[model samples]
Target: MFESLGAFVDHLRAQGKLVDIDEELSPDYEVAAAVRLIDQRLGKAVLCRKVRGCGMPVVANILARRDLLRLAFASPNDPTEEYLRRIGGSLPPEVVRAAPVHEVVHDGDFDVAKLLPLLLHHEKDAARYISSGVTVSRDPQTGLRGMGIYRIQVCGPRELTISIGSPPVSDFLAKANATGKPLPVAIAIGLEPLSYFASVVPVAAGVDKFDAAGTLRGAPVPLVAARTQPVEVYAEAEIVLEGEMLPNTQREDGPVGESTGYYHAGRSWAARLTAVTHRAHPFYYALVPFAAENTLLMGVTREADLLAALRRKFPSVRRVSLTQGSVAMLAIIQAAPASKEEATAMVRAALEGSMQVKTAILVDADVDPHDLNDVQWALSTRFQADRDLLVLRDLPGSPIDPTATNRRTAKLGLDATRPADQAEAFMRIALDPAARRRVEEILARLT
Candidate 1:
């Protein structure tokens, strides 16, 4: 909702989820550091109305918490299940002619320094980065489109070194490279918060990302063809940049701090830019790349992948949770596994589907898989470390993983499910629905 982002911000302020800063905020590590701190201490979105150099106001941490996420994915229910069910639904993106993002254009004098509040995050980061750009690209061969939130470094007013690896988009970019063609891509920044979450879904190649965005919103996302390129982009997008990744173009991308609260270097892939453009008074959107949004976006992809893997072997798999604290590396599955081997197989399938996954636990159906304490408790009571814990080594984890020691890392699977022969014995809580409903009704009335 290009037109409605202002309304959403107003709503956030009314609901106490948005923080307004009218004081001087610098584009350097100052703004970035503050956003990082906001994410860590009191998770909330921030809108900086004043920055030291820029004429336009800058809004950072727009998707800082579940409150903002709920706003993005709002429906009769909540954002998580409501948005996810859409992903599994048939709603396709409906393209429109044009919108507000194209109201003004400035191409030849592409100076991000003059416009956006490009931030230098860590003390050691090489230069200021356009860290939260939603890069959109199309397969040169099949013409299929993909998009993801990728980091871009502000090398010059005319250039942004985009990271083109790490998933569905990268895989397609690789295919475009092998065929000796330039990857036609566009970066769309600053749209409705729900649109940002929709970009991060790691669906396989050939699947349209915009359609997925539409499905998640329970409607079609409107798109406009970029003024400079063939790529159709978010017409309501505040900033859109068209570019090309020439075959074999590469660079030394990062040593920046990542999601694990540590540093990673040389894992960076590279690309070249062709054009940079935005709205006349574009409010640049950036996230503290390693903060809450990063954790949530990545975890959502992991959860999707994990669910797919589990359902393949264990048809009884009821739920799969990618925990908030342990990151995507840890997964817990709720299942009615018929055998010990079947429980173990569920874990194996999870690890195989997710390249970065480090641990998987199979638990009895009675326990809520979403709770880490419940999973941990299951591990403590039902699992024998020597017998039920299976450790795997030298697996390929997420290259972005700071915790994984290269190919030397190990993944452990815990078979926390009750023994197949005694399934009924460990079926812990035995509450009748009528009794539970009566207690709920009494609590509701008293409150």
Candidate 2:
């Protein structure tokens, strides 16, 4: 596996999965537009070497493709199962005395907006955001280190606001708030791919995230102490922002676009930057909200957990896939149900299983859950809306979802599996094995 972002970028370039633009692009919108277009059309990561004002280059859409993720796992089996297997063998992080991020330190007055090329991804965004920073902080209660990706809105030269939605950090904030003290935080930006992926894992409370990252990478992650904060950051990280989340400070955080393809504006916690550390020439990592990379990173662990839960409850569940275009709001499950009642139960379990899953489609084992076309065909032929569609009233839901009312959402499940009574009638048309093989050989030779 690649050890650092630079090494991974080099690998992407060698594999023709990355494109570099020498043209000067504005961080306001131009860089985001180009990144979205390229990712949608060719599914390539973008590296803008010349920003209009900032000196560091910007890279986005690197985690958009599953093949790239496969390279990280280096496994033939499912990534979710692989992650589950590797996570059980946790490896502790190794502390280091020196790191490249400490080579250049800004301990005094400095403007964050002037230092990094923070991108304004959406038109209605309240301010520029650092979307890809993996924030590392310790739980005040347990003293265990935790990491998560948070949107850091740059408010001023040294002030900022962070969205503390997930736990360990939120828990840390609560404990600090109770004591009228600030929680120290270190935001590490642009590390290796596995570091970011592991940070987002829904690890149990009190579990150290750096160890989870090290487990995924099959090696101990080298960590260096933050200069200004009491936290530790990945040693090979390109940049580290040392700060403290204020005890009682509140700020209007967004109108910024989120992973749900909608603008989310809310009052969030504020923080003050104490120091900024980085290498001589660091790459600024940018993530476009509502894009494949954002959704994929957010959904990877969710899908894995959902699949594991569904399987434990219903042994018939074969596969689970969170549709990428839905922003992790939709899940397609492939299963072989023993009866229509069992199928409906599985569908209901799926919808209620994950918070992000607002729509669940249950397809038969014959259909490929990952392929939308195959799932659609199954839905068209095997489903009867009146009989198979199950809708539930308002329930707890993801806050990022635009359609939710008061953070409550109505969810639905569609059982697209062929009814056992009509199995013969709904039998698929197919060619014989020998004949299909002969045709495939001829087509292969012709190609």
Candidate 3:
């Protein structure tokens, strides 16, 4: 695994998975447009060497492919399961004195907008947003550290609006606000793959995310205390912003595009920036909302977490996959069901395991959960509306879901596993081995 973002970039470049753009691009829309194009065509990470205003280079689409994540986990066979097992074990972070992020510190009288190459990804986006910053905060009650990826919109010279919709940051902020005290926070930007993966994991309350990150990397993550706040940040992070979320402060946040491919209109609490620290030269990471990188990073790890949870409940669950295009709203479970009841139970277990999954489908071990076509075929052939479909209404749902009414939506579960009695009827037609070999030989010769 790479120790830093720069190292990861170098790895990608060597593998021909990264593209370097020398032309100057505006952070307004040009950079985002290029990133989307790259993702659509080549699926490679882009390094914009020159931004119109900012000095640092901008990096996008780092986590655009699931294979990249597989490489990061260092597991070729079962990356998701490996990631789950790794994160399940905790390794406390090592607090160090000297760190790379402290090489250049800008305390007081610095504008965040002028410092970072924040990108305006969508047309209706209110301002340039820091879409990839991992916001770190500690619970005031238990002193448990929490980390989450939140949208930080540059609202003013030294002020930013941060969306705290996810846990346990949201819960931490609420507790701090209840005490009428500003919540101390440190935002670490441009982190390595393991730290980034751990930041997004929905760990239970009181679990330290830094430990989870370290465990994922098979080592302890080095940390350094923030210069301005009483918080710890990744020692090798490219940039660190120390600040506090002001109590009882709210601002108009988004009309910006979210992972759900819809503009989420809402207000966010403000974080007053106290200091900005970074390496002498750093790469500004840009995660475009609703894009492949953003969706993959958010969805892939979540699927792993769900899989881990489901496997504990139902050992028959062979594999689990969340559809990437759906932002993890749809979950497919490949399970070896003893009976129809077990299949239905697996579907329910999947839904309970991951709240973001609005639709859960269970198929036999023969079906590939990752293949949308395979899952759809099973749904079309084996699923019965009356007997197989289970709909749960008025369930808690994602705020970004456009179809949800009042942050609540209906969840659907389909047991698509073929019945035991009708196994032969559902068997797929296959070509004879000798006939297939003859066609392959001819195709190979033609190629």
Clashes of each: 0, 0, 0
* Cα TM-score per model: 0.83, 0.94, 0.91
Worst 10 residues of 2 by lDDT: 66-75
- For 134-174, candidate 2 gives per-residue lDDT tens digits of 88899777789988898889999999999987786888898
Best by TM-score: 2
Local error of candidate 2 at 393, Å?
A: 2.0
- By lDDT, highest first, what's the ranking? 2, 3, 1
TM-score of 3: 0.91
Residue 255 Cα positional deviation in candidate 1, in Å, after optimal superposition: 2.8
The residue-level lDDT of candidate 1 at 121 comes to 78
lDDT of 3 by residue, 202-317 (tens): 67667888788778888898899999998888999999999999997999987887777878778999989999999999999888887787777767678887877787878888
Query: Mind giving the per-residue lDDT tens digits that candidate 1 earns over 1-447?
Result: 424456677777887887787778887777887777877887888787777788767676666665677666655553445555667654566567766787777677667677667777787787777767888877766777778887777666665567766666787778877987877778877877777778887665567777777777666777878777788888778877777776766667667766676755653445545555666677877777677777887676567666766676678987777766675677888898888887777777777667767888888887888777788788887888877878777788876566578544668788888898986677676689999999999999999
When 1 and 2 are scored with lDDT, the better candidate is: 2
After superposing candidate 2, which stretches have Cα over 4 Å from the reference? 421-424, 430-447
**What do the candidate models score in CA lDDT, each in turn?**
0.73, 0.88, 0.86
lDDT of 2 at 37: 91
